[model samples]
Target: MDANEQETDREIVPERLFQSDSNTCASVCGAEQTIRKDFLDMLRERHDIERHTRWYDIKKKFESDPRYRIVDSLYREEYFEDYLHIMKEEKRKERELREQRERERHRERKADRRDRDKDKEKDKDKEKSRKDRGRSRSRDKDRERKSSKEKEKPKEEKGKSEKIKKRETPEEGEHREESDKEERAGSVDSEVARQRENEAEQKQKEREKKLRAEQSIREREKEVQRTLAGHLRDRDKEREHHMREECIGHFTALLTDLVRTPDFTWKEVKRQLRKDHRWELIETLDREDRERKFNEHIDNLMKKKRERFREMLDEISTLQLTSTWKEIRKLIKEDPRYLKYNSDKGEREFRDYIKDKTMTAKTSLRELLQECKFITHKSSDLIKENPNHLKEIQDILKNDKRYLVLDHMEDERNTIVLGFLEELNKRGPPPPPTASESTRRNK
Candidate 1:
């Protein structure tokens, strides 16, 4: 490279150090004096004095002139190179860590395989030892049987000799009887006769006692049996009485239910009554009374069902899909707070109605109406453009509770819109749309 090119290569990048208020180049230059000539010689000779300091002076001088801006541009490319180097180091570190984890997994699998092989070898050795021990035990049993046969022959010969000696032995006896002997014999006979008489008497007494005791026990058993029979009869009668009362109570309740419904067949009602007497009595009620009760019951059910239907409708209305601003405006006019409907309130009311509960639609409708109050113009416009955008608007409205109450009224359900004309007719004519019309601008 030539001297000029070498000088350019060592050039420094300048920063925005000068305040806008001051333009005196002399004072600014004092902070970072620049080299006038032989910049390459200064760079080569100044190996120890911070190279950045010398470059800083060059940077300050070059920064003042717009023509030197291109030279300043090169510094950014170098700075980017440094950042790239740092990123490469980080990537290398991550790769090494992943490789280390893979090595550990490989080592674990190898060690487990080796352990399995060791266990297999140990089992083979144990099986061999068991077979050898079984063979040795069979040979010892054969030797023991041979020794026992030799000992049995000597034992049988000894037993025969002893029996012959016993047969050859003779007995000796004296035939004379002394007075003492006779007296002793008579005493023995007398003692034995007394013992026989005593035994007979004891047996006879025990038999008589046993017979008497048996007769008394039999009589007592008969008495107990009679008492038990009477108690059982009383218990049966009590159970029958309780059963009859339960039957009567059930029939009475069923009869009242049957009387309130004209369509209730006499045969069917009697079955519910669960008694022949109740069935027969129900068939005799006056036709006029039966009809009145039946009409009253039907009216009550219809009124309840109508209320439930209204609640379900309110819930269904709250389930809006994404709607455009124009659609929202129309919905608002029909029901001013319609866009503000609470999905929770609508869903809750729906569940209750489905479960046959009465009167929750009003609260849910009111919540929906209140939410319509907070609709921002931009969002409201967006909601109105998409006619099918009610679902999204409902979701936004349902999630926010800030619209639960309105500035003018607490109960939004009562804020009747054009859509509620049918319900409002029952009350009276609704006042002309005053503020309602203002909310409905042309798209």
Candidate 2:
């Protein structure tokens, strides 16, 4: 049993130790390879833990083997890497959004600050104005008080009661005296009121009389103003009538020109026509007519005048009036002053008579020329046989005092030539015109 057996045991133990070392190294290599393979799978798979995990099994596995720590650690590392990157991007976006919101809030605050400052400035100005108004109002009140005080005066007379008041008197005595004074004051006040009533009655009567006088004066003034206004209006109407007469004269001249030359402006013709014939006082007054029959009478007179004048112009055109002029001259030669004079006047009257006839002939001749163009051409033939008649016709055209008659010849019924003759017959023979017929014709 001894040394050889101990050496054999030692050799066997060395062999066993070598074999165990080899086996342990092989197991460690296999475990490391398995762990590496699992790490690669975890990386590739990127496992989800939040939704798919069963809590009980996971707890059991952790409690049973604690090797779940390795898988969990691996999973957490991958999970944290991707999740942390996403969280960082979300944080950056949130920061940008918050910055934008902050910028908007800052602008709103600035605008609100400006508005508040403006309102505050306005309020400050208003407060300053109100304070100034208060000071000015106080000054005005003081001035009014001073003016009132200055206007009050002290009385000069002192009564018996005032004299008595300066002496010391008993209270009962003072009361009895005061009652007596009050009774006396009441009696005096009644007397004063009676006097005032009498005075007021007299004053009222005077005032009433004065008011009646003033009313009468005002009525007289109103009557005068109304009469004056009527007179002034009548004067204005007379002036307008004169102006219309002048314008009508111009219109008649233009019409005569237009008849001579047809190329005249109708616009001017219409304007002159409207100015001359568009208005009449009767038509204007017709609106306010209180007497219909009077208005009708005036209207009838005007209508007759217009109708007669128009009819006569039509007759002159139709009758070829030049033949009558020839007959009138022959009759005038037979009896020189038969229709012209009474011989009571001198040659001056005879000249006036010839001038009047010549004027009538000129106006009648113009009407003949305008209305009877064919007759005027035929009348020219009479000049060859009757040289005297031609001389008279030339006198009527050039040196006759006919322009004056032309003024009134516009209305045959209202011709001034006939009106003057009627008026002259009513008066007697008048003096002839001093100027020559040529000067009268020029006028």
Candidate 3:
């Protein structure tokens, strides 16, 4: 029984240990998750992490915060990297969606324009066909009128001959009959000549009218042709512009991370780009334009690099408003960002950083003083009334973190406060509302 109890105790002891271990692990994981959540929240609230932001920069920027320090370094870096990737993917999707929308809108507008042009062409053709049909009807009517007149004229001539025959006596001489026949023949010839003259006049009028109609139609066609030519020219210009922009975009895209650096020369970059199929896209661009764009790209790359270097300097824990480049350089000499510029340039940038830092500190301190309920527009008068009031105000400001940032510059801080007081005094207090103004506002 003792041996059996000993074995059972051993088993129970191991089981308890296993349970305790599992609980500890669960608690640790829960705490880690909570810390990670807090850190991410802080990042979301304060930091605008972009694609270009580096891990080193983020670490230096947030290392002082409690939330950032709670998470393990490896986990923090992993989370940050994952967040950056997610953000970049989201931005890329958004950009693609916008471009797709723009392209769809362009296609819709183009289709609408084509439909309108087709409708206009159909309307013009309909109007032209209607005018042609009307002209044909008018021509048919004129022909019928002329034919009826010709038929009636012959009938009248026949009737006149019959009447003359009725007037003739049987005993008339042959010479008289011959003379009458000659007169009849002359009259018939004159009448036929008059009919021919009228027909010639009518033909001349129709020809002139036809020529005028043809001239108007030709003028309209020529105008339409000119308008079409103009539209074609404008369309070609727009197409060329779009092509040029697309080519430039393709050329810019060809500049990968390897070639997009301040260190890369235009000649070297051009050689590398020529090997790529995208080079053909910029064939329409001149050598000068290509070189110019290359130079601009380099300039932008250098500018971004310089800005990142400045941000690194801003985040350096060892850096101070009073720190010199010589001291600061020693601390950052091992950093890769430090090697980007020579000593002289780095010194100049450090000086600028210090100057900007001092200004920011001063501004923050001033704001703190302004926020104090003790300080007012009439602070100057109060100080004059009781010199202890100024000391009290200074004591109140010294407790704030912002005031400590510029505590070394006592005179500057005092000057800022005095200047603010002066400004407030000059502005003066707002006037009280009159009876009329109050009544109007109530209404």
Give me the candidate number with maximum lDDT. Answer: 3
Give candidate 2 misplaced runs (Cα > 4 Å): 1-191, 261-443
Across 212-244, the per-residue lDDT of candidate 1 in tens digits comes to 999999999999999999999999989877655
Could you give candidate 3's per-residue lDDT for residues 1-443 as a string of tens digits? 69999999999999999999999999988987888778777777755577866676457778789988877777888888777887788899999999999999999999999999999999999999999999999999999999999999889977976786688765554566788799999999999999999999999999999999999999999999999999999999998897778667767767753474688788777778888765776899778867877888888888888888888887788777767777888888988787887888888878877888898898887778768876767888888899898888888887898887776778987888878878877877645579658877889
**Model 3 regions more than 4 Å off:** 1-201, 264-281, 431-443
**Order of candidates by TM-score, top first?**
3, 2, 1
Candidate 2, run of 10 with poorest lDDT: 281-290
| Residue 424 displacement (Å), model 1 | 41
Structural similarity to truth (TM-score) of each candidate? 0.19, 0.20, 0.52
Across 1-443, the per-residue lDDT of candidate 2 in tens digits comes to 89999999999999999999999999988986676455444433434333323333234333343334555554544543454455467678999999999999999999999999999999999999999999999999999998777665222223444565666477855796789889999999999999999999999999999999999999999999999999999999998786556445444443443333222344444444345432232233322331333344446544554344334334342222223434333434444333332333323333443455556666664554344222243344454467565446444544433433343344652343334334434554333576556677888
Ranking by lDDT: 3, 2, 1
TM-score, structure 2 vs. true: 0.20
Report every candidate's CA lDDT: 0.52, 0.54, 0.82
The residue pairs found clashing in candidate 2 are none
